[model samples]
Target: MIAAFLLLLQAVAPPGVATQVAPAAPSAAMPTASVPLPPQDWSGLPILPIRRSATIQANTSMYVHGEVMAGRCAKAVRTAQGWTLTLDLAVLATPQGRFRRVTPRAIDCPTVEQYAAGVLVGTPRDAIDLDDTQTDTWYRTSMTFTWAGS
Candidate 1:
């Protein structure tokens, strides 16, 4: 049983270095531009948890409310508690595991975009992990802000 367990562990662990393979030559019939790109692989990237702060939550709620009231965004659905704001973002990380950039998808609300970027920027370095083989890559992530009691 112990030998089998050790074999399983070895299979699960990443190899010290990845083997490289050359790309196949393109055929004359198919154009590279027409080929659909594969979706990004986010398996190894860290998923940072949302750290809620009362002050930040209050400010974001106020900003969201103002945006809704000013006709900037469609009326937000409000529950007995309050409204929820979600931001989808792509974060670029360097080979050294440092976060380089935070890009938020255009949601028509500029302040909200900035808020999401701010949250990503405030994340500590220790929270992210990167392997030397990853190089520079963009990882997709999201944050949802939910305020209760308006």
Candidate 2:
């Protein structure tokens, strides 16, 4: 399943774009269980039917599109997990439009996943084909978050 998921990511990713999975770290107080992702189905394909450029732009906008948080740092930041997180997402077609679903290839922190999902879940730039004959064409996307240190 892991191999299939990686291959799907490679097959659908845009040119020059790379897919990375964040590594997990051990913690004295962290839980041993893992977060669950949506089950794989025909809708699990990585590439979306929408224009790739537009989708890319929208996804990128999620990071720097909000208010600036300058010079307020030097504050103590701590987590039971690693500071960086990488997540695999699938944009699926829905009656309302597009829905973002996380296919948790690697998730070390539930908080990080929740934060990312809140920022990410939304309709795609273009509508996906809803035809019954469609192969459930899905888009594969990844997001990585890295702290200033560690």
Candidate 3:
């Protein structure tokens, strides 16, 4: 009777049924989360241009390279929070290639004078001056125009 019962148990069970079942694994470290988006636009809307003022300055050797060079000043307009102004040492007709350098005090004018003179916010050592090789080292600068709310 005992041998018959053992034969019945062996027939019901598989060879390695205990080994087949694995223990549950602990969960991984909590995954990192993404940053929240700004409360502004999420739709693929093109940004409408804000009419900010612009001032462009070119180097002394600007016209020597057979290129038309000029310094430009544009008028400022009012904005919602505050007005913003832009100053860039840009090339007019030159493609994605070499151009001239506009030093910090290079293009001094009444418009950019107060901002430049107040306190150079973020320029590197000695301002954006000419190196021995004469390439434009892009040091950063920023200022707030509080005089006329611009």
Q: Cα RMSD (Å) per model?
A: 16.6, 14.7, 31.4
Which residue ranges in model 3 land beyond 4 Å of their true spot?
Answer: 1-74, 90-150
Clashing pairs in 2: 46-139, 46-140
Q: Give the per-residue lDDT digits (tens) of candidate 2, residues 1-150.
A: 344544665566444332333223548886643422345653446454443432334433233222112322222233555343355555443443434243433344433343344334432434343334333334565555544423
Question: Taking the tens digit of each residue's C-alpha lDDT, what string does model 1 give over 16-72?
Answer: 311111122589985643222223554465544334422354665676677666777
Q: What is the overall TM-score of model 2 with all chains considered together?
A: 0.36
The clash count for each model shown is 0, 2, 0
Off by over 4 Å in 1: 1-61
* RMSD value for candidate 1: 16.6
For each candidate, what TM-score against the reference? 0.54, 0.36, 0.22
Pick by TM-score: which candidate is best? 1
Which of 2 and 3 is the better model by TM-score?
Answer: 2
- Candidate 3 lDDT over residue span 14-72, tens digit each: 33211101112345774533222222322332221123432323321121111111234
What lDDT does each candidate get?
Answer: 0.55, 0.41, 0.27
